[model samples]
Target: MVRASAGRIWSVSSNPCQDQIHYAQLNWDEDGQPLSSVFGDVYFSRVNGLEETRHVFLQHNQLAQRWEALPEKVHFVIAETGFGSGLNFLAAWELWLTTAPRSAQLHFVSVEKFPLDKNDLIRALALWPELEFLSQQLIDAYPCIVGEGFHRLSFMDGRIKLTLIINDAARGFSKLLTTTDPLYSQYSAKVDAWFLDGFAPSKNPQMWSEDLFSCIHQLSNAGTSAATFSAAAIVKKGLKFAGFAIEKVTGFGRKREMLKAIMPNNSQDYFYPQPAYKSASTFPSSWSINTNLDIYPDKHALIIGAGLAGCSSARALAERGWKVTLLERNNAIASEASGNPQGVLYAKLSYKEEAQAEFNLTSLQFAQSFYSSHWANIGKKTGVLQLAHCDSEQVLQTQLQEKFAAADELVQFVSCTKASEIAGVPLSFNAIYFPNAGWINPAKLCEQLVSHPLINVVTGIAAFNIQRTEHGWCINNDRELQAPVVIIANARDAQHFEQTQHLPIKSIRGQVTYLPATIASKEIKTVICSEGYIAPASAGIHCTGATFNLKEESKELRVEDHQTNLENLREPLQELLAEWENSDKHSLDGRVAFRCTLPDYLPAVGPVADEPAMLHSFASLRKNARAFIQDTGKYLPGLYLNIGHGSRGLAYTPLCAEILAAHINNEPQPIARDLVNALNPARFLIRDLIKNKR
Candidate 1:
């Protein structure tokens, strides 16, 4: 595992990163309806589930009316306790499509401990033929692997976003409520409507507890409202105790009564903001630092560098109606590390359940689905076989089996014999076979991302010496370009700017050798990854090697590095290498590139802070680690960052782009709040203060 000593702010887990999802066990009723065996309750009302959903959730929440009244480009958020069958979500989406403005977006966040299997969810959704058009779209994009934490899915050309939290209801909300960053906390807690759609409080009492209701209260604002199918006394007391004015409503189907509630204007109750972890005391959770900052996308944004980070950021912002000017120092986009002929789309996951590992797993899953639908022409879906290079075969296999009990379709532990069969070649070690991992051409992806009409690409201009202005910010190179917002995504070169000079970013030189594919080597069908990787031939040439040399930053390729790459591949593909050598083609040809990396191996994303103001405001943190000073640090109003991706740019860039876009547009975040804190560009600055280093 990649280890770092940042105190308890970042926790490491010895167990694998995967959280086996609890799938719903279903039984078909006589009327061709689905029943949950564990909760002993039907998914929806016995009489007309669709109409019942429209009344209890949509009509009670006033979604159609609220959506119609929203301004253009405004985002409406809806949070729910249960996500059974996804009928409520489809209903909300269909209503929003017809009632809401074209520029407006909908964000739906839901938590459910037991998610249905893909086939079961598809079958259950199929029963509602009226929603066939919407159901098919959801089924096509639904996550195949249902691991825990957050599973984010985007649909309708980035107009609809769904964040599915696969965990307990109360615990998940508690975790979300612990966010300390004011810029992110407001978005995290801003829920407009609540759908209390879990099984009846009688059958599923754990989901409707006082704690859960209190969490809902904490997340709700003065005008927030809720609707539920239960009017049980405990449910009523819980909502009332949590500050919602509750009222009995007409029950659906055979129910005697239902409930509708709203946060009263005179209600005066608030929960104490909890810390994410016991030892995280560097900052108070109640600070509303950036809550007042207006992030409307009315002005233009200037983005530096046209690598994956920059291009994807440009696309995300442009989709939100922001005019974007993408600047690249080189003559073309992706002409550096992202300019590699082909980049692998796999994540180097660890058993350690730290923030880095969690980010990798989520981004890996997101990229696989994203590339297939958006960039299919430039990407391939050939699965990857990651060999066990550090530990014993038995130990690796054991960990894989225990961690991914429900994700057999996503990955499997294969013995050497099975590994060879999958690779279509000879192999020497057991491997973790990733069925969904593959490769993509980064240059093509970069080109496609910046093709929007709202984006203007400026090439061959190296921006330096950026300064905060009265209106926004100014970048001066050969010319001056000013924008309300600026994003630095120029890899390690981002440190050239005075604001980011202290960032812990360094460059590592890497070289990849290309081998002409022989008859035997051409038969290899899958990407084989050991200490180094050997991809199957895409253009009659198999790409392999890639020596990671930190001491050298020279662009020149040395023959020794090529030899090292070949030597690293000898053991895993001895037969293939021997056959190619026998053909008298010993000369090695390749390309060299540099990768930007951080000490902790996580990318620096989110808004940049004014260093001087931060140092003055949080000065007390250096003396006493737990100091609760009144001053929240200052941020550079429009300056942001998206850099330090290391070699996982293909996997990390897409979601980081979406996160940055959401932060800029004041939209609901696609991932959890804790994970966002982990990826914050200013995390190291906070670390330094906590350690009394600055």
Candidate 2:
């Protein structure tokens, strides 16, 4: 670990991606304090960890005072270095809950290279019985695999949000600081307080490197305060050089002294001036405006459609202090595309590392973890087995396993014999088993999402006539409703809006047949998918097929669709198909639904553009594709869209909703830059312009 010089940018170290996490080797000292064998340092004060955390972190930072004085609906952010046993985080959360206004939110961001496993966390948290209530929630929501990425966990009905980045301190802080994604813009890479809780400078010197301090300085606002148990010369010098005014403080228990520091009020000198967004030369144009401008107003949003997209979007925005009004034409939520009894959490992965495949993999993992926390009993963790039906599919599966470097937790290739044993059924072919994949009840998930206190769902009202008013956009019908921001999330019906009519959204009709689970068929444990899929028994029946038809519109259950389902089931459940074929046609039950999709099959998320205005502005892109234009594009101010998820609604909608929330809040996005562009609703127009097809 090299030290960073003042006025010199420190380069981030290479990722420790493949390195196994070094768990803390705990040893009890004579005084009964937990000691780390690797670092040879105490985990906390020998006298008391809880009191030390409150004094060294909370008192020095004045968290309780700051939290009490916070403005309404504001989010107070605290970033910590080493969240060993999360003592600091727990103390802060408890203080915030007691001191802050009910409407204010607390966002605690922590970086940990080596997180304790569930059992370890439980054991360690047991030391603080007073914090048992909060610790239990964290334990329940903790990531099982602890994969490399940001894991966001919300508690207290979304009032408290914890974003745990499991990575090296320097690497995580650097990645976070460099992100231009809108989801993180809310804080501008600044935090209110810092908990420099790594082991003592002598014991774990690597964690207190100058690079780490420099990164911390970069993420701190002018008034950021930090406290640490170490008052070593290097610790003090690094923080002082990085722009914080430091002082030695009285230490807890037997410790001689600790350090406390605060960035000066005028300490903007640490950061370079933010440069403008680099407009893509081939990107579409619209009414010229600043690309970095945020358009959200008054923290209120009106969302059309109450299905998965709408409800998820509503929940995301509501968590961010936005009051959302969700409108559905049907008398109840999820009465359309999201009304399926069981939706499989399928990834639909590809061999090619394209945007779709990458997005699917990440979204699958996020949704699986997210559903386990939010949708608990409504979903099953029975892994999904995707069999290779053709030569091309077999090649793709092989590539996915070998070339793409898929992890066993995410997916693994299995032979016919292995697949049969895993599924508890006689299988025909080899498969890719997604261990994290499962099945969810779409309607139930939607119901849970809209139940948030910040979301006001109004069903049985069709918002047909919409007009841009001086106040905001107003929806007119028997009743008039208005909000500063509006989101179209009604799947295919989004096209009913004049602004969205130009969108190439196609509604594909589909039907899923349900077969009564027999003693033999009930043995089918995992969801088996080839051309079609069959979920494990739910309510004494298994959901199967989903005959896709582009032209069909009628919702009536067709006898032929059931036959098609039976035929599709023969390959996977050979014996069960014979029994089902012999049953009465009327006994065959199923659900008919429409899946909204785009020409390119990606969901239309993010901001909506003024299509005609953009076309007129960037029409020349058709002639000169390489021309660099200053204008990115013009989005209808405060207007956004989250639709066209197709059949992977369960897998895609949650992440898409998060993306929409990020755009609305002008925060950093969770996904990469290119992937964010792929979900842009204006991409179709940009493609048409580049192809000279306007």
Candidate 3:
């Protein structure tokens, strides 16, 4: 057992709240079925696991019928207590592909305390050759289940999403709850169905606790259905105590009985014999959902800006069956900050598990998987090395390594020699190696993202004015384009809109120096970052530098900026710098662009709040910052923003896009509720109100 102060590494038993991840310990039966060594139970029925899943969960839940009846552009969400061998999820995915509407999406959220290792998953899933196609996809995109929290994986071209939570059932479900605070009123998670499949109650009784049932109840709504293979009294009682109407059904195979349940449309009909947990205070008005808004009645979205944010948002929505009009002010997509030849997929993580660090880690992991899925076309997985050039950075890296020791596959603290070997170039200092991080051509990625059939791209068209009409918003351009939903992803120009003008987003000029790769410089195989970064040569030219300047706007490349880049790289890549120094200084080439950033370094995402209205609504905060104002935040209905990614846009955009899309569709969020609040667009306004600055 290896333990650290913050979390444990490879410990058989550990606390989920501490971000420890323990893989399932399994023993193979005679039939090659996986038996959980910890729970003393089989993962599935050995006789016929596929058929059992189809009968116990799929058929019992009426998924095929429900999916068939789903309206166009709508989505169905299924939450599960245990992810086991992923048999149930794969079976559901297979059925959904053949039965669900093409325009509808399927979101499957599952919690697994002990996720299988990649090899174990591959072997277990191989038992059924019929599910090979779907199984291969899952295998290819399986996240490195090394820590707690949600690992969101997109499948079937975004039509199916898996939010795999590696934690205890009760704790995982609690995270899905709208608000964990007793002071904030809770909201149901719009979970259409639940699959209560795990080890038996006798073998794993802790998972069938009342806390788990309460969370299930909180995340469900009237008419939400559930199916389980357990008919134990504890299971029945817990479900009933949490207001589910259950019936004992014939079990699968040797089992004599199973359970199927649903929440009735009327609360009076609920079987809540005892008092269920209730919030003492009203839900925060700022985060409330206004039913009258009806922003998503039509699944059409107009995205302003054709950069990484806009293109990513368009693709995410398009994959969910929404038609998007992508408007670009420049001659082409990615012609602004995203036009660089190669953008390093770098993550500046903190030693502590604060919001910024957590967000960066999650986004970095997501971006790595996202780009890996697109491989050679988008970028190379050449990996990245962040040199600890200074003593402070070395100490920070040491702390970070200790904090994430279990996640060795994601990051590693290496000696100077190891770093040099990994980079295929001589290095003078120790570094943090990101094995999955690399470089991406933002332009190529943006083009591919917007190439979806549902996305309509318009170039050289700027949306200067936006007006909210009776039905939706209208963008003033060559021709007025209207959409029920609009996303502002135009970088620094995001604040130019009347609704988002109050946003404290600023433009910082950055220039990337282009150096012709020599034989010596070409030896550098991975991205190396200190004050700036240099990627492995792409097309015979190494992209580096990226000098940061504040309040300066010059599209032309500056020689001084090029010199600044070289000087920054002098210490870290001294050997390579010597080789490149002989080149003509005046002929050096580079590109200049401006990045949009916020004071907090977090991007502005989610719905655009009506500034004045929110200030007035939460006016009591001015007098007492902690005052509980029970009012929903006033927002410009259907307007959202996905900007302020700063220099880390490549690492931030993918997950942020998924977050915005989830908000629009009312799906289970891909991240924690607290992280959602951290990225909330109204955060600045709330801070100002608290400080009495308004």
Candidate 4:
């Protein structure tokens, strides 16, 4: 196990010097079997890997029988220690489709130190033709595998979701066990099954350590089943130490014995005593608390606001078989910031892997895949080019290029000539090119998201006077509407409600200039960015500009803002600007909207905390900020928030919606615990209390 301190067993560096992912090295034998070059072990049985996986993982965990017995609209979670070639996940998915109810969802979370390259994965899975359909889908949606964090991919119309973590097994699982605030560790979702599939303990002892078993125990509850192909003494001893009841089982092929275990239904029947070090005053002991609020038995939700945040949240919940009531104050949906003609899909990554940089990169990737799969008809995958217009920007671009050297497919530096060739226009400076990045019509995308049968979109009705009721919450508007769950996604207006009044969100006005596409301007094939961005022509017009004004409140277009947009393009696209300025046929027109943002620039997602209750609960921090308080912050039950996306609503909303839905459904989170805490709705309150302002 990797220890950063005396008590902490899983210590991940917040800012590691090297963040590039290292893919698994493999050697193919004459019989077309993959052997791990690092561990000198075969990835699967030489004799039928498919049957081996079905017998060892699926049958042993009783997944097929359990899936058949699952109730409608329920979800089952299965976590794996190592994801070598994704065979186990594919097998589980195949069985789920055949046995599980259509309304049921399957979530698979896997950790891998060294994931297989795309080509290697394809080659390995090709041996089984029966799984070609599902294998192809997995291959197509697979991430670039360049960074060490959670990469969530959805399949089968969001019925099957995968949270792929590219990190060490122990460290990655530890991320799910605890949040940034160690006291909140009890909030993690417990796994229903565990697949301990990796190299043998003799060849790879690190993967079978006590630390990993402890994480497994922490992420499990009564009746959690575990299966593995190893029957070594260390494996048995570790599982027993972690309170699992183990039994020897028949091996798959050439192996003599395997192990199958489950957590006893009663805690008193556990074999080993709880570790003393875990309960020490200096250690984190909140995991012993049972703080999980009951998931609303009825899968129905009411969401306020119909913008990108609201629409995305509705779609996410609807996909999981929930009936959603989407309320919009305006006469139509996407009439505010989401009504933009075009929005760019790209991330501004920093040199280090901090919260802002990491969240942006992760969200951008998820948004690209989401739009491509769901709204491909209205979106364009024409790529984006970020020009290095100044010395500081050039230096930053260079540093980013070096930082992501191993991920050339995600982002790469291109010469001016090469960039021009790619963009189909003349360029003066070098740029960073994101091949998967492009532009999407946010209004159309929102329409597509809310078109689901399970989501009822109600317009022209403003929700106010939200009050807690005996059954759930009620919004007293023109007509009273009540539901067991509620999500506030009205951007800056989210704070208008009494429960969320303490949120410190501000509105900044931004205006986008619409320039009719000229013959010369139509030649621009890709979205180009410097201080401002100009997208390729769509419907004979190019959407550009977006001047950021903090104090402006008027929604009318300003001539000065239009001039500023043109001037902002001078440094990056001087040649194109010169051609456009001389043309009298083009008229300067634009649209103005307000962007809701926070002081830290990160969106507020997940469950909303009760302001008055939290202030009273954590008030002890005012006296001593470092005190180890046992009391967790108080939260308003069944209340959630998905707002403050600012100008990047198109990029941030999809993943934030998934995170919120996961918390609501009581499933595994799609991101790390630290990132989850970063986007917590009560973060500002915690900060104020720490500073003695509350």
TM-score of each: 0.91, 0.81, 0.93, 0.94
In candidate 1, where is summed lDDT lowest over 10 consecutive residues? 2-11
The candidate with the higher lDDT, 2 or 4, is 4
- Cα lDDT, model 2, residue 352: 52
Winning candidate number (lDDT): 3
Ranking the candidates on TM-score from highest down gives 4, 3, 1, 2
In model 3, which runs have C-alpha deviations exceeding 4 angstroms?
1-21, 181-188, 268-295, 477-479
lDDT value, candidate 4, whole model: 0.83
* lDDT score at residue 160, model 4, on the 0-100 scale: 94
Better model by lDDT, 3 or 4?
3
Q: Please tell me which predicted candidate would have the highest TM-score against the true structure.
A: 4
10 residues in a row with least lDDT, candidate 3: 1-10
Q: What's the distance in Å from true for residue 346, model 4?
A: 1.7
Two-way lDDT contest, 1 vs 2, winner: 1
In model 4, where do residues sit more than 4 Å from their true spots? 1-21, 178-186, 268-280, 283-292, 477-480, 582-587
The models' CA-based lDDT, in order, is 0.79, 0.77, 0.84, 0.83
How many residue pairs of model 4 clash at the backbone? 0
Predicted candidate 2 versus true structure: per-residue lDDT over 133-250, tens digit per residue = 9998888777643234566667786688777776677766655652333223223436778888887878778778877877777777678888888789988988887789998989
Please write out the lDDT profile of model 4 over residues 519-593, one tens digit for every residue.
888999999998999999999999997899996789878888888888899887787787666654236788998
Which residue pairs show collisions in model 3?
Answer: 285-631, 285-632, 285-633, 286-633
